[model samples]
Target: MRDRIFRRGILPIAVVAALSAVAGCSASGDTDSPKGSAAPSGSRAGRVDPRSAAALRAVEQATVRAGSARIESSTAMGGMLSLKTDGALGWSGDQVGTLRITYTGGQLAATMRALSGASMEARLLPDAYYAKVGDTFARRLNGRHWIRYGYGDLATLPGGSGAYLTDQLRTTAPLQPVRLLRACGDVRRVGEETVRGRRTTHYSGTVTPAALTGEDAAGLRKQLEQAGVATETVDIWVDDRGLLVKKAEQGELVGGRMSATAYYRDYGVQVSAARPPAADTADFKELMSTRGS
Candidate 1:
């Protein structure tokens, strides 16, 4: 029962991490030119609507500078898994954060409960992610309660964005929505909206393969294509202080539709996460190796 449970639960959780990383990666924008084709007439220097461009730039700068935020998000990966997470993340220098992830529904959730538990605490650090499992899982793993997945190991996963996933998780997850808005080729104002009782300006755009640029841009594009996502729609709402208040991404992946919505607040909030005790933690790589053996 222990081996069966571990085999079924561990990889799906890892997929959750990869999916979260990929969702953030979708937000990388072209910082050099924020005036794609969505600019309005009389806009500054022939750029897209000067207001739109400026707003995006302002939000981007402010978010990066603030360094930390409280985040709540829900993600659905086709019919495979559904999850909700709430936590605080800091990216002032190195990525550090913690999230309480609950398996709300799906086959993955059932397996998770059978193996570990319905909820887990995901601890994020510069080099790795750690998930705290239930007592049953701990007993199976020589009494270790946490599973560590190092970014270095994720880079070797089979996929076009495998390497990019590692880089994005470590460097870009904090301000991904702003990055996506910056990279949009057709950004448009969607009027005013209220988010969590706070007024905010909404913006929407499509991120196509051509809009991406960078060393890993080509690879990411190919990965998206393979996942059946030729173009992704990204929307963001910015608050009065030029901070991202909410963001959403929708696209097709793994032969099914995938979508995620995230809310951000408490900008500049102080946050920290410490690695689990070595004696109580198990490395994911070692687990895989043992399973293979």
Candidate 2:
């Protein structure tokens, strides 16, 4: 029972983490703005509003400058899974962070609990992620408690090439919405709204292929094409101080629809996530090899 649970649960957590990481990365594009002044509203259907563009640029610069933030998110991958993550992520240099992830509701939740308890601590490093599983899981693996999943290893997983799971893990940050805004078209203001009790200005746009240009945009477009996503809708709510308060993205994937909503706060907060002790760690590749044998 424990072995079965371990096999089923650990794979799903990795899948969920990869998917979530890709979702965050897919929304971002090149941060460079086209040289020009802000255009008047309603100037052209395809033209981005000057104020909206400026707001996006400001938020992007501010977020990158802030370095780190507290992130809370809910993600649903069609009917495959639904999960919640509460954590702080730092993007000052390398993508270092930690997330307490829980399978709130899904077919995989029970299996996850059986293997890793009700929650898992994911420690993110520059080249890999480490998952701290429960004792039941540890006992099955020579008392190794942490599973190290290198990004390169993840790239070889099923459907990984198009998913950009590895690339996203290495490059994407919590402030991806601002990057999305840089390449967005049909940008429009949806008026002021309250997000998490804070007043914010809402903006929405479509991520069309034509709207995205440049080398970075071209790279993202290829990934989207490979993933069977023609277009995606992105919305963001920015606080008065030019910080991203909330963001939501919706798009269709090969299997079904995918959507995620995330809230950000406490910008500039310090976040330190240390790798697990080597003595109690197991490399995911070695575990997979053992299972295959």
Candidate 3:
């Protein structure tokens, strides 16, 4: 039981990462090539108030044009876990970046404490995201220090956030919040506010799989429904330049309550993420196969 602490604790906690943010664990080039990018959820969508809709459109275009940003975010999924991520993410190309993920508290944090204490490194790419869980993981997984989760492979998991995170990562560009808000059809400006000392405009809206439209609405709706997300409240702050500066989302999943807040800065910044050495990494799919065998 003592020896299995780290290994056994990874899956559920990783899923929470996905649920709380557009991040999570798993990867490997050694497995069959992962499937394709995931499809997002959506609903029927509301008829937007023309003016508000146009404003949000500008935010989306401007944000997507910027390409990348530095992020500091925190998430708490009810009582399951609480974590903070400090990293940079790039969407100019395929998603590529790195984040220092720290489990601050909650049940999962205690399990993680048994391995790397409380923090880990997540390397993200378009194809997979690798979790570096320290040397203990290396020794346990045949000298592999990293675990690779391929998006395509994650999609095959029946009830895991593997697929959800993949799909979100593919779609969760800095401009994504604007697009989702546009789908709300009733997005409203909540007056001006100051974030991190910068003046900004705040917008609030409610979104559900059944009311989301635009882009891949139907597909996302189904995916979200499968994951038990009935409705979600979204709030975003946009700077004078129409760039998204921050966003907060709250909702309930099949597991419990989930909430995440992320701040974006230094748009157009350079972000780099290099894949780890293959010999030092284990693919979750292959690991499962080995255990099954």
Candidate 4:
């Protein structure tokens, strides 16, 4: 890639595109991006069953109580971008973790290839996140191997991607999907199914912007409204212990169709993501400055 194109803002645009698709995930170490839309599986919100509501409430509580988990997820944005991520996240309070993100296909894949080959490490923290850049790309970044995306800086993003920064910061916790499902209110038990050899109870529901609860609800509401997404399908499978075992969400965006599936295991696992070396890190906004990028 030409230095001028990159400095002219290619990387940030790519980051924004990837962020909008994932809703709040960072391109590198900040892979805790938590929600993806799915096909609607049950009745509308107005007629929720008492049994289903109670069960869902249990899941929400159990998941949050677990505190942390190992996560493997895949996300796709229509024909634009697709990726797989495996990471550990902790959310007893502020979300924190690290993920290995691999670009599998779509428009963003090419840019990621130029930036960091197929995959790179992402470290998520409470106040900011970091993405690892490849060696050659690091040279362009003045030998900095890490890019820091401060939570506050996210608001300056050019488009809708900026709107979900708060959600990502607040909801990218391991238990976010279950929290969203419980908050949705209109849901049903989709029966029990086996997941990776374990028996699990499945639940499905619709997530409308208005039904959104938890971190950054207003921002997410506006994001869906701006995207013209009236409703999206969300499905979750919970093990007998009330812990979420798998989650799938599918929805539409202004750019194209988007979907994500995530699997969770090893709850109560201790996870940590120490910040990268300050000497080797560059703030994202620093790259946008009128200085040598």
Q: What is the C-alpha lDDT of each candidate?
A: 0.66, 0.67, 0.66, 0.67
Model with the higher TM-score, candidate 1 or 4: 4
Residue 68 of model 1: what lDDT?
89
Q: Which ten residues in a row have the lowest lDDT in candidate 3?
A: 24-33
TM per candidate = 0.82, 0.84, 0.84, 0.84
Candidate 3 runs further than 4 Å off: 1-9, 12-47, 156-162
Error of model 4, residue 80, in angstroms: 1.1
Between prediction 2 and prediction 3, the one with superior lDDT is: 2
Worst 10 residues of 4 by lDDT: 24-33
Model 1 residue 279 lDDT score = 95
lDDT of 2 by residue, 122-226 (tens): 888887888888898788878988888887665435544524655556554655555655775567777887876999898776665556754367766655665
The TM-score, computed over Cα atoms with residue i paired to residue i, of candidate 4 is 0.84
The full ranking of all candidates by TM-score, starting with the best, is 3, 2, 4, 1
The residue-level lDDT of candidate 3 at 33 comes to 11
Off by over 4 Å in 1: 1-23, 26-47, 156-161, 171-174, 213-228
Per-residue C-alpha lDDT of model 3 across residues 38-91, encoded as one tens digit per residue: 112243246456777788889878877898888877777668777787888888
Per-model root-mean-square deviation over C-alphas: 5.8, 6.1, 8.4, 5.0
lDDT value, residue 171 of candidate 3:
58
How well does model 2 score by local distance difference test?
0.67
